[model samples]
Target: MLWVDKYRPRQLDELHCHPGVTDLLRKLMDTRDFPHMMLYGPPGAGKKTRISAFLRGVYGQGAEKMKVSTRSFKIPPSNSTTVECQVLDSPYHIEVSPADVGTGSRDTAIVQILVKETASALQPAMGDKHVSFKVVVINEVDRLSHQAQAALRRTMEKYVGACRIIMTANNFAKVLPPIRSRCLCIRVPSPTNQEIREVMHQIAVNENITVPDDLVDRIIAASGRDLRRALLMLETAKIKHYPFKANQKPPLVAWEEFLEKEICDTIMKNQTPKGVIAVRSKYYDLMGCMIPADVILKTLVKMLLKKVSGDTLKSKIVTFAASFEHTMRLGAKEIFHLEAFTANVMSAIKQANTSQQQGGRAPSPSGGS
Candidate 1:
C-alpha cells in the first residue's frame, strides 16, 4: 500500500493548517448535521481521508452499518506499521466471495448487476433505528452509473434526516446535478508549504524516519499540497537517505537555492515534446524525490509577483504558463504543448528586450517588486 494512504490524517484536529475549514466541519458535524455535502479539492489534498475521519469518528462502531458489500475493496492500512495475516484452518469450510468490480456501461455486466446488490446490502443498516446520526462518506459519486446514482439520490434523500453525504472529486462538474443540489459544498483547499512541511515532519517523527534539514524542503517541494504524496516521498527518501532531525543544522543549500533548483529541474528536462511523460515524470519525481511542478511554479510566481525586470512581462508569461498547465492536463501531444509553452516563455523573455538595454541582463535571481 502507498505511504500516503498509510499516513493519512485520522483526526480533524490533526489535519495541519486549514483550521478554518476544519473548524467549520467540526461545528457542522457536531451541530448542523450536514446533508449530501460536497468537498472538492485537488487530488491527494486529504479530501477522502478527511471525510473518512469524520465518518469513522462519528460512526465507527456502526461502520459496518455503511458497508455496501462484504467484499473488501483493497483499502490501504492506515498507519506506518506493517500488518500481516496468515491462512488459518477453517472448520467452518468458509467460501470467499470475490468483490464486485469496475464501472458500468463499458465494464463488466457483473459490475452493473452488483450495483443494486451493493445498494441493497447497505440499505438495511442505513434504515432508521440502526442509524442515530447521518452516515458521512466522500466518494467519487460522479463515477456512479446513472442508475446507481439515481438509486443513490433516493438513498441520500431518504436518509437526509438520518444521513449526510460528503462526496468528493477532482472535477465537480462530473457530479450529477441532482446530487450536487441536495447538500452543502465545501472546498478543501490544498495545504500551503508550511503545512505540507509540518505534516512530513510529524510523519517522520512518528515513523522514526531520519530527515536532514536540507531534505525537508525537497519533500515539501514535491508534495504540492498533497499530504499523502508528501508522506510517501518522505518515507521513500528515508529509505534512500535520512533528512536532518530537530536541533540539528538544516541543509546547507538554504530554502532559496532549493527553490531555484526545483524550478530549473521542472522545465529543463532533456525531452523531445513528450509533455505527458514530462508531467507524469514530474509527479513521479515528487512521489520518489519530493519535487513537484506546482512548487516550481510558485517560485516563478514569486518572481512574477515581485515585479522584477521580467515582472514587466509577467502578464503575458503568466497567461501562457496557465495555458501550459491546461494543455498538459488535456493530454495534448506533449511535444507540441511543451514546445508552445516553452516558446511562449521565451517569447515573453524576448518581449522584454528593451529592458536588457539597461545591462543586457535577464532578471536578477533575487525576486523583488
Candidate 2:
C-alpha cells in the first residue's frame, strides 16, 4: 500500500488546498439538480482525490468500497469482435476509463454501451433513502478519441436524468466543446510550496516519523508542487535512509529530469549529422528503459525551449514541437515521429544560423576588382 493511497483524504474537509472548490462542491451536494461536473487540472493536483472525497460526502462510506472487474461487450452489427473493459464499481457508483477499452472503433462503442447500461439500471432501495440516480466517474476523459467523445456527448445528454457524470481530465482544451458546455468545469490548480510542505509535515507526524525541516524543504522542491509525489518521495526516503538526517536530500531518482537535460544539452552543444546520430542512440537507450516516446518528446521540448535564446528561433522550435507532438498522437510509431522532430529542430537551428550569417555579411558597397 503506497503512502499516497494510505493517506488519501476520505472527506472534503481533509483536502490540503482548494478550499473554495470544496465549498462549491459542498453547495453542489445540497442542490437537488446539480449538473454534471468536469474537473480538469495538472497531474497530481488532487483532482481524483477531491472527486472521490466528494462522492463519499454525497453518498456514504459504501462509496469507498470500490472493486475492479473486467467485462466484455459485443460490438454492434456483425458482433464478431468484443471489447473488454475494467470498471471500478462500488455500492454507490462506478468508475470507468473508456480509453482502456480495446483500441480502434470499438472504443466509441464502449462509451455508448457504458452510458446505456448505467441509464438502464435503477438504484436499489436503501433504508430511509430512495435515490434514483447513480454516479459514474470517468477518468482521463481527454484521452478518449474524438469519435468516442461525440458518443459520450450524446449519451450524457440522453441519460442526464438517470446518471450523473464526473469527468476528470488533465487537458481541458482537448475535451470536446459540447461536453465542456454541458458540465460545470472545475479547475484544480497545483498546490503551492507552503501547502505542500504543511501536508508533508502532517503526514510525517501521523506516521510517527521525525523528518527534519530542511529535509522537508528538499522534498518540497523536488516534488514539483504535486502533493501525491511529495508523499511518495517522503516514504521512499524513509525506506531508503531512515533516522531522518538533517539536510538530507529526498531520495528521488529524477530520471525524467536527467534524461531531459542530457538530451537537451546534447542538441544545444552540437546540431550536426553526427550529433543527430548520437542523440538517436541515447533515445533508443531511453526507450529500452521503458520511457514512453511521447513523454520523452515533451520533456525534450521543455528543456530545448529553455536552452534556445532568440525569440524567433524559440517560436520556430515551438512550432516544430507542436507539429511533431500532434503527429506523435496520430501516428502509431512514436520513435519515428520523435526522431523526425529532433532532426527538424536541428535543421531549424542551422537555418537560423545561416540566415543570421548571411544578413551580417552583407555584400560590400564596391564590387570586387
Say which candidate scores most in lDDT.
2
For candidate 2, lDDT tens digit of each residue in 30-112? Answer: 56347899999999999999888887777767778899999787887678888788998887678888887644578788778
Worst 10 residues of 1 by lDDT: 87-96
C-alpha displacement of 107 in model 1, angstroms? 10
As a whole number from 0 to 100, the lDDT of residue 245 in candidate 1 is 50
State the weakest 10-residue window (summed lDDT) of model 2: 360-369
lDDT of 1: 0.52
Give Cα distance to truth, residue 118, candidate 2, Å: 2.3
- Across residues 285-336, which tens digit of lDDT does each residue of candidate 1 receive? 4435544344445454554444335545666667766766565557534434
